[model samples]
Target chain A: MLKNVHFGPSVLPFLLVLPQIIVTLVFFIWPASQALYQSVLLEDAFGLKTEFVWFRNFEELLSDPLYWDSFKITIVFSFLVAFLSMSFALALAIFSDRVIKGSGAYRTLLIWPYAVAPVTAGALWVFMFNPTLGIVSYALSALGYEWNHQLNGGEAMALVVMASAWKQVAYNFLFFLAGLQSISKSLIEAAAIDGAGPMRRTIDIILPLLSPTTFFLLVINIVYAFFETFGVIHVVTAGGPAGATNILVYKVFSDGFVGLDLGGSAAQSVILMIIVISLTVVQFKYVEKRVAY
Target chain B: MIENRPLLTIFSHIMLILGVVVIAFPIWIMFVAASHPEIRMTQVPLPMLPGGQFFENLDIALNRGMSGMDGNGVGYMMLNSLAMAMMIAVGKIAISLLSAFAIVYFRFPFRMFFFWMIFVTLMLPVEVRILPTYEVVANLGMLDSYWGLSIPLIASATATFMFRQVFLTIPDEMLEAARIDGAGPMRFFWDILIPMSRTNIAALFVILFIYGWNQYLWPLLITSEPEMFTVVMGIKQMLEAAEQAPQWNVIMMTALLAMLPPVCVVIFMQSLFVKGLTETEK
Candidate 1:
C-alpha cells in the first residue's frame, strides 16, 4: 500500500517527462546504438554490405601506425592543453579574486574569447599567425625567430593546443573564480592571523576547498578536448603537416565524414567512447573522494 | 578586508594587470586587425593602433558574395545562425526544464531508472554518434530542415541535469504548501518552481545559446544547400574560396560580426552567469 501510494504521485511526473524520454530514445540512444553496431560491421553506402566482422576493425586499428599516431597525439594534446590552460586559469582566477575595482570589466573582456565560435576563433588565430601579413608573424620576425606552423609537426600541434587552450581558459577561470568566491573569508582571515604565509594559506586552506571545482573543470576539459577541438583543427591544420595533429576526433571526422568510410569511422568512435569512459572512471576513482565540499 | 598592506595590494594589482593583458590581447589584436585594410594587414610591422577602415571593411564584409566571398557580405549566414541558435536554445531549455521538474518533484515507479537514463546521456556527445544521428534524422526526412537541427539538440541531458540540480535546491516545504493549496503538480511548478528558477533558466539560456551559436560540425554535416549554411559554415566557405591569402580584414570583420550575439547576451546576463556557476556546486 505504501509503495502504491508513493508510486501514484510519481506516475504523473514520469508522464510529464514522456516527451524527453521518447526524444532521447529516438534521437540519442538509437543513433548511439547504430554507431556502436556499425563499428563491428562493414557497411556500404546503400547499407550494411557485409556481415559482422567482429574484432577485425579493432585489430586493424591497433595494428595501424596512423591510428597509433592519432591516439598518441590525442593523449599528449589533451594533457598539454588541459594542464597548461588550468594553470593559467588558476593564476588568473587568483588575481581576479583580489580585485576590488573594475573586476567586472576585466571579466567581461576576458570571457569574450569563449563566446566566439570555435570556427571563428580558428579563423582569427590563423589570421594573426598568417606567415606573411600576420602581425604575430611579424612580431616573431622582429624578435629574430621565424614562426611557421605549416611546416613543423611539433609546432603545428603546439599551436593548435595553445589556440584551443586559450579558448577554454576563460571558462575554467570562471568556475575557479566562483570556487574562490564561495570559500568563506573568515577561513582566509584565520589562516592569516595564524601567521600563515600567502603560499601556505593557499596550499592549506584554498586548495583543499577548491577541489570540487577542480574536479568538475578536469572532467569538462577532457570532454572539450575530445569533442570540441576538431572544428578548430579542421580549420587551422586540416590535420596537416602530414597529419601530425590528427587527434582521435579529427581522425573520426575525416575518416567517417570526409573520407566516406563510415564503418572505419564508427570503429574509431567506439574506441573514443571507451577511452573517454575509462579515463572518466579512472579520474573519479582516484580523485572523487578527495574533492572537498 | 586585510588592512595597511599597500605593498601586497600593489603586487596584486601588478599581477592582475598582466593577467588581463594576456587574456584580452588576442581579442584586441583581432579588433585592431579588423580595422585595417588588406595591405596593412600583411605589412611587415602590423599596425598596433586601430585603423580607419573598420566600418568600410565591416560594410564589404557584410554585403559581399552571398557566402561572404569576394571581400564582401556575411548577412544571410548570420541570419541562419541566429535562427538556429534561437530554435536550439528555447527548445532545449523548455523540454529540459519540464523533464527535470518531473524527475525531481514527482514520485513514481522506475523514477531512479529514468533519472539515470537522462544522466547517462550527458556522457554520449553527439559527435561520437554523428553518422548514426544523421541516419536517424535522415530517416525522419529531416535533412536540412530546422526541425533536424533543433530536435537532435533539444533533448539535451546536460540541461536536464542542470535543471534537476537547481530544482533539488528549492525548499520542499514551498512545494508542499502549494500542494495543500489545491495546486496540481503542473500548477505548482508553474507558480513556485518556475519563478524560483528564472535566474537559473536565464543562465542556462545564455550557455545553450552560445553552444548553438558555435555549432560548426553538425551544421556542416546536416546541410548541403548553400542557402542553409550557418555563419560558421559561411566563414569556412569564404576561407576556401579566397584568391591568394584570406582577406584578413574581411574575415576578422565577419568573425567579429558572428561574435556579437553571445557577447551581448553574456553582458546582459552577467550576474546570472556567475550565479549559475556557483549554484552548480551547491
Candidate 2:
C-alpha cells in the first residue's frame, strides 16, 4: 500500500513516530504486560509479601461463584442493553424514515443523548427512579409496583440497564438511520407494486438488506455494553445490593481497586484483555467481509 | 417513500412522537429538577413543568458547589473538563496526524512493526488494564495533572488509521508537484495536507472532545484533588454528597451544566460529529 513515489528513510519519520511509540510502550504495552505478569503472581492484601503462582489465580477464579455470577450478570446485562437499544433505535429509524417532513427535527432531537456521559446518564436515571423522591418511582407506587432499587437487586440491575441502553440508543439510531437511508427506494417501490404492504416490505425486503448493518451494530452494542457501561453501573449501583449489577468491567475495578485483591483482579484484567482481543479479531474479520460486500 | 397511506402516516407520527418522548424524558426530568427548589423535588408526582429557580440553582452550583469543601465549584470543574477535553482532542489529532504522515510518506525500517504496535493498543483499553496503568501514571508522578488526564488516553489507533486512510486516498500528483517545487516535508504537511484534511480534523476534534469530556473512569482514577475533578466525574461526588445534604436542585444543575457543552456541539455540529464517528470507527 505504499505510494510509488515516497521519501527516503530519514530521522524525520522516526522523530515523527517517537511520541506515539513512547506513549504506547510506556502506558499501553508495559502496563498490559504488567497485568499479564501480575496475573501469575500471588500478593497479599498488604504490600509486604509476594510469590509467583502459576494458573492458580485463574483456577480460583474459574471456581469462584461470585466471578461466575459476575460473568452471568454481564451476559444478561449486555444482551438486554444490545436488544433494548437496537430494537428501540430500529423502530425509531423505521418510523422516522416514513415521515419525510420534520425528520431532521426528530433526528436532532433524538441524537444528542450520544453526547451524554455514561455516569451522567446514570445520574439522571437514578434521580428519576430514586426510591424516595424520584418521579418514576412515585408513579410506579401509584401503579402498585413499589420500586426501590436501593434495596432490590433486580430493580437495580434494570435501572443500570436502562441508563446504559438509553445513552446507546442515540448511537444505534444514527447508524440505523444511515443504513435505512442507504437502501434503494426503487426496491421498496417494487415491493409495493407487487402488493406487499409497508410492514411486509419491512419484514421481507428491508430487514434482509439491513442485515449487515444490524450485525455490525450488534457487535458494537455488545462491546459498548461490555466495556463502556462501567460508568453507568458505578454511578447507579456501585455493584451493590450483593453485587447484582456487577458487570465484568465493574467487577475488575471493584475486585482490583476497591477490594485490593491484586492477583484475582489481575486475573480478571487478563481475562478482560482476552475478551477484548477476541472481540476485536471477530469484528475485524467481519468488517473485512463487509468491505468486500 | 412508496405512496404513503394516510393511516400509515398518522401511525408513523404517533410512533415517532412516542420514541422522542421516551428518549427525551429523563433529560426533561433533569431540567425540571434543576429549576425547582430542593423542597419541591423531594415530593412524589414531581412537577412536569419547569419552575423559575433556574438562575438561583445555577448560582448555587456555580458559585457554591454542593460539596462546599474547597475547590468544588461546578464552574471550576467545568473549566477542568474543558481543558482536559481540548488537550485530548487537540493532542490526539496532532500526534495521530504526525505518525500517520510519517508512516505514509516515508519508507522506513520497522514501519509495519510500529503500525502493529499501535494496532495492538486497540485491544488494551484503559478499563482492562486499570491498575497497572494507574501504577504507571503514579510512578511517573502525573496523577492530578492535565497530562495524566489527557496524554495517556490521547495516543489512539483509530485516529491514526483514519488519517492513514485519508492520506492514502490523496492524489500523488499533489505531493509530486510540491516536491518538484522543492517543498520540505513539514512545509508540504503544514501548507497542503493540513488544509486538505481540514474537515476530517474538525470532525475528529468534535468527536474526541465529546469522548474526552465524557471520560469518567480514567479521570476518576487520576484526579483526587477537588480542583482537578472534571465536571462529568464531579457529578458522582455531588450525588454522594447529596445523600447527606439534600441539595437536589444544585446537583441537577451541575448535571445539566456537565451535559450542556458536548450536547451543544453535537446538536450544532451534527454533520461533523457524524462524520467523525463513522470514519474513526472504521
The model with the greatest TM-score is 2
Backbone clash pairs for candidate 1 read A10-B107, A10-B108, A133-B42, B61-B73, B62-B73, B62-B74, B63-B73, B64-B72, B64-B73
Candidate 1 lDDT over A128-162, as tens digits, reads 77777677877888999788888988878877887
What class would a CAPRI assessor give candidate 2's docking? high
Clashing pairs in 2: none
Expressed as tens digits, the lDDT of each residue in B161-260 for candidate 1 is 7788777777667766776798877788789888998988888788778889888988888898777778887777767765366577777777788878
TM-score of each: 0.92, 0.98
Specify the highest-lDDT model's number: 2
| TM-score, cand. 2 vs. native | 0.98
RMSD of candidates 1 onward, in order: 3.0, 1.1
Give the per-residue Cα lDDT of candidate 1 at A163: 83
Reference interface contacts recovered per candidate: 0.59, 0.82
Model 2 error, position A281 (Å): 0.8
Interface RMSD (Å) of candidate 2: 0.9
Cand 2, B chain, TM: 0.97
